[model samples]
Target chain A: MKTLNENAQSVGTILLEIGALLMSSGASTNRTRITMERIARGLGYGIELLITQRALMLTIIEKDQQHFFSRLKRISPHGANFRIVSGISHLSWNVMEQDWTIAQISEEVQRLKALPHYPRLVVLGMVGLAGAGFCRIFGGGYIEMTVAFVATVAGLFVRQEATKAKFNPYLCIFFAAFAASLIAGTAEYLKIGTEPDKALATSVLFLVPGIPLINSVTDLMDGNIQNGMVRAMNGLMIAFSIAMGLLSVKMILNF
Target chain B: MIFLEIITKSFWAGIAAMGFAVLFNVPRRAILSIGMLGAVGGLIKFTVMNFDIGIIFASFLGATAIGIISIQMAHMRNSPPLVFSIPSVIPMVPGMFAYKMMLGLIALTSIENTDDYLQSLISTVNNGAKAMFILISLGTGVAIPMLLSRKESIKKSKFNKKKEVTV
Candidate 1:
């Protein structure tokens, strides 16, 4: 009985760990459940997983349906990391096709966890250009686009610095939005651009929580109503944070 | 001249999509494809909207093309389709509409007269509903391929063949 319990506990830890990784990396709830299940089946066990925005509850059972272990893992804050999601999906196929051992799978997970993100400078510059694109698409003139580009780079820098300082995520968003809007608003005040309103609108477009909004709707359609509602609420809260930031800038500049 | 306009607009849209792809930390190999698909999606929407087809329908058409193309790309790229579709469609997201709706609602709340109140309400509702419907269309458009794939699983096909063989 002791050996059986120990064995179940060891495998169950990895299963729950992988599930939490997938969930936090922006796998849709349905895909999270499916991937966890596939990995468990490959290891000759069965699983029942319950995913929530804050935590994941898992049950590991014998192949013949005898319950063995139940565990709950608190997920870290969610971030959109598509590369991790794809890596785990590919890992699942290998588990089935190549019949990987638990040891091999865990090593791969570690490797995935260590995959280097693009340099911070590249992301900031590219996203700044994206802000300029938003301005152009909104019919801003070249000057407005230039203002937006500068504002976005500044805003994103503030956001990263705040996040690094360990502020609340929503507060980071608020500060970023405020910084972006203030620059764009100052440009508007100076009459530096044609259609500065478009610049103001597009300057903070980088922080719109687009991924969460789309994932929320996708989750709802997949019948993961609870996770869907949580994600939608998160998106709304971020949107509201952005609005408050912009409103504060408007009040300060009194434009 | 119109072609030039479309080309420039789409080029920027692709850049925006690639920007988002980096933010999402998509795989390195998929980034270029994500950019090209983003441009194509934007091109279709702009071309369709030029004909007065309307923003909502244009978004649906653009998103559907993204959906179809993302799925085809997924098989070749070995990544989930959503990894491509989500960031690509984001360049088309109607964020400004929502911003307008919020401001309009604030205006409606403080109006001094009934006429102003009605005007505020009209614009607020108009922008809000437009944003809502466009979002729904984009969601449905993107989901169509994944949902449709439900009936095309290999296991289902294999099961049918086995039944036919037995018969």
Candidate 2:
């Protein structure tokens, strides 16, 4: 006989495990949407809204004097069971896909149990260092700025493709270049009292754009609390990756 | 030597900038054009600012010109300006400037010196205001044309609307 608190904790842990599995199994964003819809329906939430980035937001609509809020609260602790990994895949120009596959979805949950996020940090760090070194040898004010600009554009274009070889490298280079250029140049201008290497390391280290942060904040401001918090958390994780990369570089370079 | 270095840097920067712009959803045709324009704008702005041009005025002009050029590129391809403007202008994001201003404010505000505090507050406000102004101006410049185009599109589709009305 577990207490409500213990049940809630178990639910939260399980939901996280499931989400991780879905993410690892490479389950498409459409599956997540369907699962969320089913959950909302099961919870007696009559209103459903889909936002950009395939975010599933549910609104409880009730007629009569029924206490719907109470019902929602009772159901929310178990809502994690409903989160599905889903997104709209753009197959080609003017061709979009929203296919759902539930069997492999569980694999994603299982995959989450065996992976570490630190490798991503290391990879990002290597990319950043390579970008910095290239820019140091070949970049200046305009060059540095353009690298980031181009990278952002690249990221946007290739976002739909899951395969890294298809588009990630070009985008990474662009992102890294602009960040490195700015970090190096600004350090020279501000005279921030630290050694040049240290200044560059700290400055460009956080240049990774917190796209999720901006998106989450906008979603929260628009009153989508659940979706907003999710995005914000994801953004925080990305920010952490950038921090780890920067710290690693600084330590290695002895800056 | 400097010329060679500048060229090499500019080439890589242009490629990287364009690559990013394209990756981020900017149309492929406009990627290099916008990036090169940005590189040129930055170079032009930096050069002009050294000779007493106000930083605000310089940055504003650079961004505006880039915006206009991106819009023109969009028009040439029979596409909307939304795609080009976002990617083309991304190179000029003032994140570093904004961060520095924040850091300066924290340091100054924390110190006991009244004069330092005043200067930090002023710098923070100035940077913030400048950043806001750039965004607003960019928005306004793009929005005006988009609105006009949408209206024109509606007017052209009057026949479809009439058919719907009758149905």
Candidate 3:
């Protein structure tokens, strides 16, 4: 019985860590709750979970002995990585299906945590291509698309470097937008693109907080109002920062 | 010509969404599905707009399509709906409207004439409201399908059955 109690506590701690990572990585409140509940159920515990934007609390009652574990980990704002979220989701489902021992679950969680991200250059290339694609969708010709592609590559490089240096997220976005717009605005000055306006607009589309905005609505609809509001505010702030960055470039270029 | 334009635009939107999926580090197998969802959503929005529907309504319809398709993809991929929904909708974000609103706000302070200032103010308000409405519509549209399907998912999952038995 003592051994079981210890195992349960370790599982609780692992769940909390996973919860914190998911929230910080931009998972919706609903996802956080569902994942935690599944892990607790898989561990064969009757658990109560309390979740907020900043903290997670889990309580388990076994044989009238209540075990409570709470962790206060501030969710740092970061880009969404669905790979990690999906990995954790699969892990919990496997736990329930396989009835895995505590040690196996912990090892799996650690492996997911340590999964290496894609190389920086590849990410930069994709961002550039995405920007170019946005330009084309908005009716830009080849010249505008090329300009957008180059500008996005440069801009995302700046953003990546800022992120690596641990700069504030808003600051990182601001710098990226500033860099992207400055480059894109050259289309207007040089009269190279048939649709300079489209080039300028699409170059900065990479900075939009589409995921957070969507997640906020999901949370609000699911009755997690507090978390929804917090996420909504964060999304708005990022949008505001991007606007500021772009406006500065526009002001300087007099475009 | 119009049909060709739609096809080209949808293709670009799909490509853009796939790029975004990569940035989000979506699992390799799911990228194509996400791209297809984005293409369909973008196509729907564009087609709706061609009928003279306002952008807000068009965005709503597009997001609803995305939400529905994402739910289906989630079932097929064995992952959450959000894994498909969020990146797919990236192409439709009202980024231009938001930027224009901010531009108008900044430009407001520089105008010396009262009439010009009022003009900028009106434009700013108009653009700002449009952006806000579009965002709300996107959110509401995505939420509707998810909300409707939640009960079905809960009832079908084996874990929930076990949960009931234990209780």
Clashing pairs in 1: none
Q: lDDT tens string, model 2, A1-255?
A: 112122222322333343333322222233333333443333223333343333223343443324232111111111011012211111110111222222232344455333332233333433333233234332334344334333322322232232344534324433443344344544444453334433353334224342333334334544556666775565334444343433443344444
lDDT of 1 at B126: 95
Task: Tell me the deviation in Å of residue B108 in model 1.
Answer: 3.5
What TM-score, computed on C-alpha atoms, does each candidate reach? 0.93, 0.42, 0.91
Estimate the lDDT of model 2: 0.39
The residue pairs that clash in candidate 3, if any, are: none
lDDT of each: 0.83, 0.39, 0.80
What's the CA error at residue B157 for candidate 3, in Å? Answer: 7.8
Proportion of the native interface contacts kept in model 2: 0.01
DockQ of each: 0.42, 0.09, 0.49
In order, what fnat does every candidate score? 0.53, 0.01, 0.66
Worst 10 residues of 3 chain A by lDDT: A63-72
Against the true structure, candidate 1 reaches a TM-score of 0.93
Determine which window of 10 residues in candidate 1 chain A has minimal summed lDDT.
A1-10
Pick the winner on DockQ between candidates 2 and 3: 3
| Local accuracy of candidate 3 as per-residue lDDT tens digits, A1-255 | 233645566766777788887887768887788777777777776667778877777666554456555444455556788888878877877777777667887798788777777787878888788899999988899989999999999988999899999999899999999999899987777877677988888899999888777777778877899988987888778888888988888889887
